[model samples]
Target: FMTLLIGSILLPVLVLVGDIVFMFVVVSAALGAVVMTIYGGFETGIEFCHRITMAVPETYWEMIFPSSFEEKSTNWILN
Candidate 1:
């Protein structure tokens, strides 16, 4: 009974913690991108942000439904 009670409480707490951590990571990544574009003299902050946002979200999406993804210069679309 105690174990079941603990599990019920712990599961939601763990999920909340995981969500908070993911949010922190996303915010940090955005801030880092802004700083990188500012100090690194990228054409625009949004451009740097765009590149990162493009690759990262796609990678996460692919993790679940990975099919045929190619990379770099060798991509068939590039050829």
Candidate 2:
């Protein structure tokens, strides 16, 4: 009974946290779109947004794109 009561009280808090995290992700994405548009032009920005919508799972991204530091290091060596 005590466990059930605690769970009930905690459930709403957990839901609120989830909502906040979702909102943050959305806002961050919007900001990224704006920045992409400003720096890369409207077409490039739209392409970026489209890519985000079509993106594969996170694990696949990790495999497909190296970290920026790693990429920079490789480019430096090549140059």
Candidate 3:
């Protein structure tokens, strides 16, 4: 029906807008945390950095660049 059509169209648009808003909120929170940690004048900055780095495992690079040698080859070709 007409309601179904409207729902299908509006649902995706709403979801996309929600995702954008959520991303902005997350970025703002991360920035605020970094600023507070840095200016708080304690070991908070170092601890935050350690926690952030520790959260990412060494295998992250493997997922990002699946083909190590091929990435360099493609970069050289493009440049």
**Every candidate's lDDT:** 0.68, 0.69, 0.63
lDDT of 2: 0.69
Q: Model 1, residue 4: what's the lDDT?
A: 85
Model 3's lDDT to the true fold? Answer: 0.63
Cα deviation in Å at residue 13, candidate 2? 0.6
Which scores greater on TM-score, model 2 or model 3?
2
Estimate, for each residue in 1-79, the C-alpha lDDT of model 3 and write its tens digit.
Answer: 8889779988889999999996996686588568868797457666655555444335757546755564434332111
TM-score of each: 0.60, 0.61, 0.46
Q: Over 4 Å off in model 1, which ranges?
A: 44-47, 54-61, 71-79
TM-score of model 3 relative to the true fold? 0.46
- Per-residue error (Å), model 1, residue 67: 0.7
| Candidate 2 per-residue lDDT over residues 1-79, each given as its tens digit | 8788768887878999999997997788788889999999999789877766544234556546756664334432211
Of 1 and 2, which scores higher on lDDT? 2
Candidate 1: residue 46 lDDT (0-100): 68
Worst 10-residue lDDT window for candidate 3 reads: 70-79
lDDT of 1: 0.68
